[model samples]
Every structure is written in C-alpha cells, then in structure tokens.
Target: GGAKYLFPGIAGPDIINFTHWLGALVTSMHTIGVKDTPTRRVIHRAADFLPIPLLCIAMVLKGHDLHGLYIGPHSEAFSAAADLSAQLNIITVDRPFNHVLSMPSTMYDDLWTAAKAMYKTEPAIADGGEVIIFAPHITEVSYTHGRLIDQVGYHVKDYFLKQWDRFKDIPGSILAHSTHVKGSGTYDLATNTETPRIQVTLATSIPAERCRRINLGYLDYRDINPQTWQGREQEGILVVPHAGEILYRAKNLSNTATKGPHRSISGGASTS
Candidate 1:
C-alpha cells in the first residue's frame, strides 16, 4: 500500500567501486524485510592511499549486508563516478563521507630547515612591505589549514607587521599560486676586483615576465644547493625545498575575513 521498491544508498566510492553488481542479492534480501545483513569489513584508516580497493576485496571475500554499511566524512573513496551511480538508485542513502590528511612529510622538513636557517638572519616584512610565496596550485590543493600553518611555521609570525593595512592581502598574507620556483642561486662578477657584484638567477616553471607582472621574484629550482645557503648573501632568503609539501598561512590585514586565531585546519581540498 505504501512504497513498492526498497532502495538503499551507498556512501563513498566503496559501494560502487568495491561491491559487485550493486550487491543486488543482498539488497533484494533486505527488500523482503530481511532484518540482518552481515558486515564483511570495517574500514578504520581513511588516510590510506587507496581505501576503496581494500573495501571491495573485503566485501567480496566475505559477503556483507548491502544495507548495513554506514559511511561518513571519514570514508575517503568518494568520487564523481560514485556520485553519478547513486543517482540511479531511489533508496534513501546515508550522508557522504570525507576526511583530512595531517600533513605531508616534505612540507615538515622544508619548514624546519627554513626556520633554522632564518633564525640568525631573521627575515622581516616591514610595515608596508610584503613577502610573496609562490607555488604550484596543486600544492595548496593538497593541504589543510592546520597543515598549512605547520608548513608556514610559527616563528615567521613574529615578523608580520602589527599595523598592516592593505586593500587586498593574499590569503594568510602569503600568496599560494600555480607558479613554480624551485631554487635560486647567485653569480659573481669581479670587474676590476673592487666590489664584486652578484647576479642572482631563479629557476621556475613559468617565465620571468609572468613573475614580474605579478610583482613576484623568480629563481631556477636547480640553482639552489647546500653550499648556496652558506653564502652571506643568501642568509636572509628562506628556501622551501619542496613547495608541494609546505602549506603557508599569510597574515590577514582586515578583520572581516579573520580566521580562528588558534590556526586550525580551516581550509583544504574537499573529498566527495
């Protein structure tokens, strides 16, 4: 007298990618009012590289109740394909699943190195000055706000100008963009040997003109090395060995878009 069809929703790509034939047999069992469906596997580690394959293998190894699987933000396998397939089913589904990564190792190491290097030199951003950080956009996509802070480091905050005022400030006061600057180096020209001048070169993914247009500097990635930092001229420059690993937060000049002072993982890539 009520509804003729009994539908169940699958959360994450796990159901679509791992389950065979929509687990139709199990769903059918539930449709007939079967009260109990066994769970084949329970996934706890959402951070693993590919969690869906693991879920699929477990489901096939020891059948499960298609209706019993519960999914949430922690289920990391959600994707476009999974979402599309869900449209075909009329069942009331569970809410979507998602999660966040703590931080990439490359970023941690780079930040630590930069912090130590800058301690003696102490790079500063004056009251009206700015410090720009350029990286591939994909790099920012991989970081959460908290992880970004770890990559940016706490000590750097001491250098921010307290009375800063600007119409437009990059996120966190640091610009994270698609441009790439891997390394930098300096060349010396000893003309007449009086006061030798140094010429610096930057290796990057984009051309020098683009960097100039955006008011950012450039350096070739390969030019920088261990010995380069030892030079006196290099003292003030903070080198981030790997942009993909580091996440940075720039200081905000305005209060309207102020984030939490605690510096939590406020933003990052979203999981389906």
Candidate 2:
C-alpha cells in the first residue's frame, strides 16, 4: 500500500543497497511534506513503465484493452471481504507467550512460505522465548534460493548490517529472507555474539545438522503432537494452526508476559 513495496518490488534484489536506501528515503520524504521530489517521480514513473512494454505486447496480441479487467464489479463486496480477512488474520493477543508452536499448512511446502510462520508469530512471542516451525512436510529451505541461504544462513538484521562488507556480495532478497525467518535480534561485534530476541526451532524434515549450520534450533518433528499443545495457553504456550496466514500481535506491545483469558481460533489457538 506504500513505498515499502518499492524496495524489493520495482527496485529488484540487485543494487539492493541503493534501492533499499532510496525507497526508505522516498517514504520519509512523503511523511515529511515533501511528496513531489524528482527522485520520487522518477521511481514512480519507472514502476509504472516497467510492465508497460510487456503489457502493450499482450494487448496487441489479444486486441483488447485491459483496463478495469482486474477490478471486481462490486466494490462493496470486495471491501467486506477485506474486512473479514483482517478480522481473521490480524489477531490481537493479550500477552506474549513463552513457547509458540507455528504449524505452517501444506501450502507452505518449502522454507519460503514456511518462513512466514516466524514473521506472523513474532509479535506474540516473548523475549528469549521459542517458536517452533512445526512442519514435517517442509524439507527444503527454498526451492530456488536454497544454496544461497545455506551459504549465509539465518540471522538477525543487525548481524548482516554491522558486518555489511562481508555480506554485501549476497542478494538482498536472500538476506531479507534469512532475517525474516530468524526474527529480530542484535549482534555484538566486539563479543562476536548474536543474540536473537527469540529462539527459532525447525521441527521439520530439515536435518538437525543443517539447522545448526543455519544458526537455528532443531527438534524431531515426530516428537511433537499438535493435540498435546491445545488449550495450553495458560502455561505460556501457544499453538497456531495454518500459522503463516495470520498476524498475531500482543495487546501489550512491550512483549512482556501478562495474565489474561485465552482465545481460540477454529484450528489455531492463543492466549488473548
């Protein structure tokens, strides 16, 4: 909905430094009453023009205008659907939990979609807590970017930011993917220590050795039974079924533990 998409979308993963930095700069400018800058115009035009050539070719081949083809006939229906989606996915929790069992569905067949479990569950996890990606079917880190991910591994954003030169050669998308799965944390250059805000454990088909190499914890998927995790929110435990689709946020933004009644979704449940 905003300029954030311009970073990786139109800017592309290559030339990531300039694209990312510029995208942020443009967004800041828009926020500070400087909306009509030359740079912003250029980027907007570029974004608009990017697909025109291909779109034109398609229009010529098909001999039809594509205008209004994508928009639904009923705007009210679309708005109502959007509202329902938000209600279902953007859930608010009363407090952070100590342990979160994030169960990515079959749609998340690879680490690419499975990684979303961490992003979606991060807001509901306490500091020093653990989030287990419980997907026995997900055996690959990424079907397309597995090799690169294996090389750099998953780490907090600062781990790469503080040591930019060492990782500058890698693709930004890959680095972004790494951090998204790792969640948030800090890296101490002097101590050479990486302290993630929460521990991310992969209880998937991926091996323990590989998980260790990638700086993530590992547990055998067979050891976990989803039914056992149900109704345990009072004990600071959370079970999120079809985890990747929902965004869970604690009402207490401090990420601290609080006592409250728990809420249960149809398939997933959490402490509200």
Error of 2 at 204 (Å): 0.5
The C-alpha RMSD of each candidate to the native structure, in angstroms, is: 22.3, 9.2
Model 2: lDDT of residue 70: 20
Q: Candidate 1 has what TM-score? A: 0.21
Clashes (backbone N, CA, C under 3 Å), per candidate, total 13, 1
lDDT of 1: 0.23
Runs with alpha carbons beyond 4 Å of true place in candidate 2:
1-85, 255-272
lDDT of 2: 0.65
For model 1 the local lDDT of residue 79 reads: 30
